[model samples]
Target: MPKAQETVLEIDLKALKHNFQYLKSKLQPSTKFLAVVKAFGYGSDACKIAKYLETLHVDYFAVAYINEGIALRKAGIKTPILVLHPQAVNFKALIENCLEPSLYNAKILKEFITATSIENQKNYPVHIKFNTGLNRLGFWHNDINFINKTLSLTKTITVKSIFSHLAASEDLNEKPFTTNQIKDFKTIAKNFEKTVGYKPMLHICNTSGILNYPEAHLDMVRSGIGLYGFGNSEIENKNLKPIASLKTIISQIHLIEKGESVGYNRAYKSDGLQKTATLPIGHADGIGRQYGNGKGYVIIKGQKAPIVGNVCMDMIMVNITDIDCKEGDEVILFDANTTAEDLAETANTISYEVITAVSQRIKRTFIE
Candidate 1:
């Protein structure tokens, strides 16, 4: 590992494996597990994460875009890949790379059929997405006829799986809505299966869906945040190990008198004698300016140093008055103990944004 880099993301593969085992234990032996490795494996490394999951016998991999699947293929990933949001322009590349596209809309469904027919491919894998409740992607339950018509009209494409997304599986307050989504999905799956004359793999649960509604596991379960060591509830969080930790070094320190200001726009002014430390990380590295002022904090040698002043594009200032810290000391932006969830809560955001926001420029060191 290159310790020379000022800011680095440490990925513990062991912790990731532990999380995988814990999640797998929640599923039936027949149910498949698809690991979501989008956003550069949640800003760690897609190839590395996928490689690890492949060994654990993860049934499938889901990426947000086609390019991610292609990158994994180039890296020699043999497991089938599901592209959640596919575009017409990449339909050609999708087939050429053997990446399965999740056909949601009629246009994509028709276009993919045309593309595969031109290639004269038979039984090409494609996942049918149903819009259960998210209102984001997938076909409506009413569109089963359109889908059946399209499939019956051609042998160029095959139904690899039928899937849907749950919006509030983690929120108990929305259990009724979640239950309705499951009901709609099951009806759609059964209708589609009978209409198409083939039973495609069915899946609808995400991480929260896996934990909160296990019976709805269907044919498979997908996990993104959970695999990266985050749980929807406190009890689950304790059982999962955080896989990523953001660390940096205190580059410099300053001693200021009363009324002295620091950082751009004079966003912070010292009320009395104060000490501040600067770390080589900022909004550009995913630590946004909103986390500045007295909101976010960095752990320095077990002591909390609240951020002061505006977070710059490449640097941030933190008040370290009471801590016996110095230049070049180790600083933890967030770790297994303080987690991305805890840090994001302080900034009024979610863990997904916190980890994905970490700049790709930061070197990632994986612990085997």
Candidate 2:
């Protein structure tokens, strides 16, 4: 909670716990919780967040790739890890690390089976992803028979779960679409259970899906942004708390004479006499160019200072004319109060883009 002396991402474990519990409260007692700690725990800190969540007994963890799962394993995470997208080349390492892979298509499924067999493994857990409507990944509903027939040929790999992704569960106007997606998944699960001769675990809900579709809670629910304190809606946002706060200190202050331009390309020219404060963070640090040219602002001494000119590689100048602040004073880019969502709105983006865009170069401080 101390003032930041440099650009840093402050992660509050307490807020994480609150968000986890808040989302967990919405699920059935028997429903499993899979915390998606991918993207460096939404650009906070994955290993630290996963370690903390492990203490709370989170049922499972998911990552976007194999190395992310490996990182969790390296961190001594004992809970099951599901790699959302696994490459064939890393199947050996995945098995070595005991990370389960989500086999979405026939090619990946076949390659993984071959890898498992070659490794002399038996019943290695794997998740089956079906493309209900997302059309991004996973097999089709008709591909169930292919998946079942393929699995029957090999005893080295076992399906641990059958799941799908909802296209837009957070948007109420897409209720019909989401409903149909859920219904399709249920059909796939049923057919899969019958053909495979047994039922693996079933899940299809993401963070927003968890809040909007309780009926589709199924056997497990995966949460990514929700655990980082975003609910995808104004009303639901009130119930969750964002855990990461991006803070920095003013490196210097400049008095701009009227009509003087600032930063590269002279993107910003002061119309009148103004005071600008330079902070040690910019596009390289994850405040993208879209947020430049007056689109984004930082909080200084309880006031908003609009960003001036184009964002630099490692710095940004904010108009601090009226703010009573000096060099070394603390500034907030985004936090619990002035959230990433609020800032992203200025650039026509979302909280996920802003938070996950935070560069790894920035120092991360944890508040336990």
Candidate maximizing lDDT: 2
Clashes of each: 0, 0
Each prediction's TM-score versus the true structure: 0.98, 0.99
Q: Write the per-residue lDDT of candidate 1 for residues 140-200, one digit (tens) a residue.
A: 8889888888888898989989999999998999999999999999999999988878899
Q: How well is each residue in 1-368 modelled by candidate 2, as lDDT tens digits?
A: 68999999999999999999999999999999999999999999999999999999999999999999999999999999999998999999999999999999989999999999999999999999999999999999888788878988888988899999999999999999999999999999999998888999999999999999999999999999999999999998999999999999999999999999999999999999999999999999999999898899999998999999999999999999899999999999999999999999999999999999999999999999
Residue pair clashes in candidate 1: none
lDDT of 1 at 23: 97
| Clash-forming residue pairs, model 2 | none
Which 10 consecutive positions of candidate 1 have the poorest summed lDDT? 1-10
Q: Give the TM-score of candidate 2.
A: 0.99
Give the TM-score (vs. native) of candidate 1: 0.98
Best by TM-score: 2
lDDT of 1 at 62: 97
RMSD of 2: 0.7
Candidate 2 ranges beyond 4 A from true positions: none
